[model samples]
Target: DRLKEFPCRIEYLSRLKSASQQREICEALKAGKIDIVIGTHALLRDSVRFKDLGLLIVDEEQKFGVSAKEKLKALSRQVDTLTLTATPIPRTLQFSLMGARDMSIIRTPPPNRYPISTMVSVFDEQLVAHAIREELARGGQVFFVHNEVNKLPQLHAMLLRNLPTVRCAVAHGQMRPSEIEEVMLDFMAGDYDVLLCTSIVESGLDIPNANTIIINNGHRFGLSDLHQLRGRVGRTNRKAYCYIFTPPLDVLTPEARRRVAAIEEFSDLGSGIQISMQDLDIRGAGNLLGAEQSGFIVDLGMETYQKILDDAIRELKYGEFSELYGDELSNEGEWVRAQDCQVETDLDVALPESFVRSATDRIAIYREIDLLQDESALNQFEKSLEDRFGHLPERVKSLLTIPPMRWKAASVGVEKLQLKGGRLSLHFMSPGDSPYYGSQTFAKVQGQLSRYAHACRVRQMEDHLRVDVDGVQTVGEAMTFLDYLSNG
Candidate 1:
């Protein structure tokens, strides 16, 4: 019978020790005994074959050997293959760019994923002990990351000396497969309070209970690596802390500063999207495509690079891309407005965040929009702006700076539109029949034009100020009561 949790029937392919089960499963897959299976490299073998395989999903594709990965690809030929890896390779980025692969980002670290508060300081035993105690007090586990596996014993001894009562263990790749699994299982089961280990803990393990991490010699790691490592903890709602300790003797590298700084910057939810995470996305894109595309990204920048990819995707999807490379596009304003005619005027307009993300993005977006010869496209793009951001929020409204030209007009005694008392009111006109004139006041004539008193005075005011009322008609004057005024 199919298991309730799984869509397909589940069966045990072999009965063997955990160490040897991977190879056994690979042989089983080769013989077509399992519909879908999960195992490590031990499951990778020449004999492995699938009988009408529908999908092959491999988690952590980076761990696979190049030849093995290539062979695996062939196995899923003409079938959908979903390879997952936390550290995305350049090839994956290319595939996403070229539309060869579908990518989904779990960028929002799970809900209540407390951003790990990281601190960079010289190694200190007291600080380490205090952090460990604090986390354990909150019923959380700790990961003491020390990359050097050879110094595992010495490190463990130091950790013991600092916190002798705390249960702890060490793990590395050199350990036997069973031993590594046992330690991981014990740690997962909450058998250990702390795990002093290598970078193997970077991905594929979710331990919400682990809320604190201490990375020894963290400056040695790259930004991406450090991000991945930091991601290991703070899976729960409780605030997590990651302390990166580096010796003062070591000259702090720029990359190290960037890594630590990113960890600090992203402590708030949804805040790190623009920085470290984007770099990961870019790196992933580069990995999937190839190193050759890296230069294109560096030259054009990430936003521009993404725009090019988006354009290519649209062209491939719709079969009609208006702007071809090397096409001479005119920037005449009249032509732009003409193109916009295809779009209904009533359609709501929206200003793209690309226009608002930063000054650079805004300038580039403006330039790109200007180059568009298609009127409907521009209108559609504008409509997108209105729909996405809605009526401008107060925060955005605050950024509005009245043009200097208008400021000059106000200074020269010219009345202009302004927001006064939350309503637009004339600078010189008022409800009460009072002369509300500025410093260089000339004339303030108010009364119905139909009234003889108003008619004679209006003429006098217009003549004195040299104001032209020529060929101008006021409908309200002869019907409903209206007021007139002239001032300097």
Candidate 2:
């Protein structure tokens, strides 16, 4: 019924195919006879040509290298490429953030799905038997990932001795592809209780009956790799478990400890994005513009790098991309305006612990506030807060005023704004004499300073121009004065 509804020819091509079969498939693809074709990296072979391929969907993209993807793009540069992964790589985030790609987030999970229950523990034979037996008792199978090929046999022997009632099979990349496929087929057919293999099982295997995976020395795997392996299970509505065994924290390196903890902590549905973000945070932002997607991001320091990047992106939007994306660039939200600009105020600006008790919630709220672009959005946010957390405290109300003040200060080319001891100061660009002086906003600011008389004063600092004003007692007062200074 499904095939009839679609009404297109479909074929599978892989290394398992004979020469003639592959040739036939390639010919069909080249002649536009095949409507849908699914296969391994075998599809990427140059022999497999396509006639005006309109769409290319690559799943588990983190497993593919950059050059391979580039070659795929070379086949059809105009092809609408969709790369799918549970854990997005750092490179993917970089491109999406740099305006090179569009990103759509699918936070909703499929119906009848269950989040995997994940854990990190020191390796012990007893724990292994318990996890395996638990799955078996529930009429499910298990995947035991022992990455070291040589050690796999010893572990398999030990498992057999400990859990003699369980039927187990060994599969690894060192074996012939045919043998591995047969073993996988048997495991899926309920011929084996556990498939003890290398991480090769991370891909091209979908058996909903396998609801648990045990990884030996999971600390050795990369963050994304661990995610993919855990994802091998939990395919059905049945609950799943991923036991990541690692060396004890006392013996493991700090980096390995973090990697282990991260996978264990993110077991909820849609945790792939969170794991990727944690990976980025643990590994810095990486070399954004280069193929080396991680490491050495600490060179310029994140704040400095962000400032330079913001300036560069703005310059690109106005200089190079202006001709092509003028409308879009001009329509970008409040983030672009306030981004490169830093706001420094002496006022006590914190989500008082009394308001939001949990430190984590307070931090998340602070981050959300920082992203809000303008006053209207912030006013709406204030209403939501009041609705959720009773009346807004005086400090909470004061905290809401910073966003608009920062946006206004940025528009006038003030890199920093400081309100200290009832005195407000707007610090202009470093090396004061820049194109900012030629902008209409700066002209309006200058007109306001002169018109306001004793309320405002301008001082020439060594690297920047500082505009000082009086009568700013609270954040609200500071925001009011800033609005008047920017426009009045």
Candidate 3:
């Protein structure tokens, strides 16, 4: 329809065509006569050339191989390139999230779209027959996806025998390209009531009338693959159904179970982002920076690796931390390191299972607390906990108090705070070179310590100021003492 308005020459190249035909298309593209050329990875070959290519578009970018994508990227260096995919690869998604590339998401589904009713169950012949019959009665089609091509014929036979009146066809990658295309075209024309096929229908095939999909051994598929296959049925307005037939739950591996569960959990509209994140957790972030960095991530753990990356990014964007700390950052691991506020205590500072029962939710809250860098963030975290989990328990409240205590201690050049053996020890950072040195605040702290000489012992070491708690015995008393020192 769009071609009628423009005076343009277009050529189509594919592996299914003869070499002579492909050569002709290439010649037309090189001569600038072809305004648009559409093909598979064949267009990425060295023989292909364009006279003045102004735009490049790759659909289902996640489906391309790394080498093919690299070649496409090289071609798009100075041209306007647009990549589209329902499920983006982790590396590409990370690039977009990190602001390395512009991204736009389409969350609104087309009119009349409904969430697919997904079911994960063991393979039962009666269940499969019932599902196919129901869709057939509604004048709709069905997609029976079996991953093994060799077993497709047996499954097709079984389906036909179960439903003698239903017309069933088979399609798979092992078949000839012409045969696959014919089977797909027939299915689209409603010639076949059910198309028993392999994963070839995983991409670029949209059948609105085929609203029922039954995947044999669905546990063998990845999360993204399962999601994309389920997507084939839910593209239209009518309600869709997806039956993931697998072995019993106990027989599946832990990772396989997680993948299936994640797919089933995120079946809402615009759940692609959540699905991608779940995929990342199931399949460790694959070579986001490079293959070499993956080893560092595996060795140091993801949380510690992310901390290092965050520090490096901060250093690059906002100069070195030493610039802010007056060379104290460079002296890290020497006298006293910058931003290292150690908290050693014997108090119960864990979230009790009775309060937050779910381990996943507790870990999420712990991560949020670990990320708090200021008082405002701490306040917000407290408010969120209250809103979600009701009034905080005593232990949880104590857990919340620790971050601000560490922040205050760091602000006043206190390197370590130990509250153990019925005594409290405060070790301040090196004098004269510290930010708190030579300031009125330091003098005020000294005077305050002197006033409590009977309750506290203050002594100046070569590199640090040591304060020993002589009167504080309980955690409450120690907290009160530390609060006084912090406030003054």
Candidate 4:
């Protein structure tokens, strides 16, 4: 209505429509008559196509199926796409981190918004009645979500019988759209004190007058669903309350119990992201690339599956996509460096026998040096060595430097460190497409690359960053250069 030129048509795609109605919408879409279409799963049908499609935006993307997502992805490959989701599933988040897709997160909450007060317990009539009376006294409405339609009447009757003066209404997916609209409109107008319904009110209903939500058997709902269901209230500045009633703790399944705990624990203003991750953990992630549905982490196990995936990706980039990736797929070193950061050097990195005298004592000191973890420990070891064997020799000092170099390299994501051939080389982790490239560590390394600009040479090795620097002929020189490059 606000836009002057492009006509927007919001089609009701929830239920099946007549063939003529579908054809009319489809024709309008194909002919570029409709500029915007706010629809449901029906819009993903084969019959729907847009003329001169330039942008695609997907909201609540986690609710869609794998095949539907694939279709959206295909559209995205051709046009600009912006996916919006309050709660993203674990697999989707992982793929974004792996650089399969770009992602942005909005962590800030709305101004003057209050966190919902969530509590969980077994069903108790007295408690429910008290909660309703409290909200009503404040001139606010209440939402009693009993998801089962058949059991809704019994609960409605109980509410009516107990609180005869309180006006109440029920709405669910089974009800006609017009009927649901009438009931919702009446409730919004304050015609009713309570709206008892199913999960239909999870999205798009923004009635600030409703500040309290009571979810019966909330354990049956997934973590994301529970978050959205509880989200029906607390739309305004008024403080909101969420009561989640479930069966006895012993009776509920392990996953159900975990879900309830997570919902109750994370009732903050911006807890949707955490809730989705909890959902993923409670109910394992599905196959990401394939069309398989959720909860496949049980098969082959997550660790083993990830190992296979890493190997396959590395192999593809090295063999099949070698020419396509060019310098980015230079070698398989990226995969190897992901595990350990080692500094290999041609110079002898050990204490001199003349300095230590006893070979037994030298070996003992070597073992102790290997056990050093931090700079503090290294300092203490250096002091002990100095006290035992007069002043420290250059070789001993260089040997001591290697430990901190490894620590610095590991912190900045360097997997393999080499100090041979009078030049030092650092190999970063794989895949080059990983989100780590854009991280602060990578940025810091880039800034220091300009310090030794003349002596340093960089390469794009299999989607990973590799840097080689000359003029570092000694072990001490190598450690100082590494500290400057990684820590600077």
Candidate 5:
């Protein structure tokens, strides 16, 4: 009915339809007579072609097979594409996190929506009966998900025997498409009080009246699957309930226990992102770039991979060197060692327990500090810490000086800077081997070092130059001396 009011023609194509119907739809699409077409993977077939497709929208994108997505990608290159998903697969989420793709998140739930009350417990038939009775008394419906199709009949019979007065129906993927559609429509029209179904209800189904869900063998499903199943309920102002039934905690696998616990903990509205991050932690993020890159990422570790990825993106976007590598160095088109600086100091540079309580949070802060690329980032981090955790302690302030020291070290071509045993050592790569070594800046630095001969000693090793400065006992003194060397 809505299609009649639209300015453009619309067509629907599906594998379930007759061959003549599909052919007519294909012809209409190819002739540009149809401005909009909705269908399944049949649309990706070579026989089906679009004349002037402008936008392609994929819903439940995570449910599509790899080949279908690949085919969609081929089509997407020529048109704008938008993907919608409640729970994104880890690969898609990783791409968005790494800035390879753009993503917009809708955190706001509809008005009058309340957080679903979730509970994980050992399966009890009486408890299930009680929940169903409560929802039924309130004029609502229920979804009882039992994944195994072979056992669904047994479960359905049990439900009927337990609560004979309540109307019940079964729906699963193994059922005929027409049968499934009929059962779903019947449920939608309030013909059934409860629908016994499989994970097929995990996507593209919404029933505002179905405010109670009971999943059998919930521990057998993945975290995202559990989340999606739970999402089927709680669509209206009425309060909803989700019961995740599993075996005893002691009997369940460790992974299953964790999944159940996580689902229970994150029951608030708009917690999908948090749940997805937990999914990534449990399941490793596969290769985002390609298959070959997966091996590199595993070998480099996620932290190092993130640093390299950030560097590559920055270099491509702004033609700048990596944060760790000060600048690119090449000799006659031959790659040389990356011009970088390292700081190795034995100072007690760590967050105090009195300052930040959580060990996990401290480690997170350390990673953030390790990735600081510029003075502005460092300053901002310090300010944030002070704002969140109160005044910066003396040691914390000293720790903030490390990044600038590293930046100063790179400026003077010092590849390695070490402070230990009341002495500071600056290691420089060989002049002949380094592109930055023979520059006028290097000469000026050398001249400046010669002036401080009394306090600093310079030695020419077989492959590099080493400068040692005595009496740098504290981190502050080390910072002061490095500042002098970099500025001089």
Candidate 6:
């Protein structure tokens, strides 16, 4: 029997046929004939039951409705349920963040990931032709993104006029479902050089040869939507390119500018993912803890909110550890708002809301953050924060580590070192030095040693390049640091 293929001796139940067939399948499952089965919601009718059911797997958890989720959860009492999802929604992320569920983040991007090259510019017919020619030279495909469905035909005609030799197709949601599917298949089969579509191309479409995307009028889409649409390309090892075309400058809204800027800044791999992750984190915080908690994050600021979350998690689960000193637990730092939180201060500085509201500004902000590594820029930054927040948060202080006389004896890969009164601490990220792993590399015995020195600091010294931080401080002054950091 096919049931044997499941490595079991149970009957098979399927509801792909008529209502009567579904009823029979449910009856079979209820009668203890089927041990492992797969079917749609039709099999979830109340009349169905299970005898000695031990495991259940719900594929594509996001596809299920709330009522269906409740019914599925009820099954959890008798069966260990495994809910699977590639891209989970806000509610699911919230459940994972809270203690309601356990999760494992698959942060390892696909193995063949080559950084996506992104460019933002006004619509240039020549650039369009060049981008298409480049992809064609590499024997690759292209995704010409003209998001407005009503103008899709006109856009398709324009593409045909410019890249006349390259076969092209159009796909949009307004078309018949079957037609959309056929066009997508045709694109995949290499029958078309470009697939001009809306955001409908945003998910679950993998075309390895397609490495170039030109999103026309990209200013209209949100940062997350733009990120997802760009993700449709760059599925191969080749360097993918994304051109986000925006409307003219004078006509552009501040919000539109921000969107385009974000697209430009997030043209790289890890960068775009980080933007998406931060968005998810903010949404998750809001959904699980209530909108009031979300507002609190705005009041406290992003880094402060993260500190609070880390503290809350530690207090509830691990309690205050003996190794962590009381004075070391204090918060001392200045706060600059991250993308997740927004605050208004009595200064000319643009608040974090500016970043959250517009993609163009977000990208510009990121680029600016990247430039904060220079010593002169860092000095200028201290002044800027002081000017913006009125006063730097006393709780926030930077950890300045000077290498010992003997660099070799200083231990390998020592990223940070700090001294508080007579106590000294080293901050490094090595599996061999991990306290959690019980592989403490340094054998130094002192009165009070701590590794929390890396809690929040602005910059890290490097041989060739510097790692910049917008704002950071020692954990000891964390709270006071937050008060100043946030208000500043």
- The models' CA-based lDDT, in order, is 0.56, 0.81, 0.79, 0.81, 0.82, 0.58
Q: After superposition, how far is residue 167 of candidate 5 from its true place, in Å?
A: 2.2
Query: Model 4, stretches more than 4 Å misplaced?
Result: 1-23, 296-312, 319-323, 330-337, 340-488
| Model 1 vs. true fold: TM | 0.56
Please tell me which predicted candidate would have the highest TM-score against the true structure: 2
TM-score, every prediction: 0.56, 0.86, 0.73, 0.68, 0.74, 0.52
* RMSD to true structure for each model, in Å: 16.3, 3.9, 6.4, 12.0, 5.9, 14.0
Name the 10 consecutive residues with the lowest summed lDDT in model 5. 329-338
Expressed as tens digits, the lDDT of each residue in 1-488 for candidate 4 is 34545455555444456678878888988998877776788888888888988988888877887878888877677799888887777678656746788877787888999999999989999999999999999999999998899999999999988899999999999998789989999999999999999998988788999999999989888787888888889999999999999999999887778888999999988888788767665555567766654564544654455567766786776667767876664443353234436778988778888898898988789878866888999998889888877898878887888888787677777878899888989888767765456566677778898777888898988667889988878766867876786675
Model 5: clashing residue pairs? Answer: none
Instruction: Report the Cα lDDT for residue 259, model 5.
Output: 83
The model with the greater lDDT, 2 or 6, is 2
Which ranges of candidate 3 are over 4 A from the true structure? 1-11, 16-18, 96-103, 288-301, 308-349, 357-488
Ranking by TM-score: 2, 5, 3, 4, 1, 6
lDDT of 6 by residue, 1-488 (tens): 43556665453344325568767767777787766676767556688787777988876564576678778878777678787655454466555655579876555677878878888888998899999999899899999888778898888788888887989888887887678878998999999988888888876688988999989888877666777778888887788889988768668985467556666775665564455444444443453543222222334544455556754654443234634643433321110111121111222223354224567754654445433434466567657655654454432212111111112212222333333432323333323322321222222211012222253332323321111222323333322322322222
Which of candidates 4 and 6 is the stronger one according to lDDT?
4
Candidate 3 collision pairs: none
- Score residue 436 of candidate 4 by CA lDDT: 53
Model 1 scores a C-alpha lDDT of 0.56
Residue range 13-94, candidate 2, lDDT tens digits: 9878888999999999999999999888889887888887898898888877767777877866888888888877777765
Total clashing pairs in model 2: 0
What lDDT tens digits, residue by residue, belong to model 1 across residues 246-343?
A: 86734776545655666666665544334444454434344333223223244465555555676455444323433462132222211111111111
Candidate 2 TM-score versus the reference: 0.86
Model 6 deviation from the true structure expressed as Cα RMSD, one decimal place:
14.0
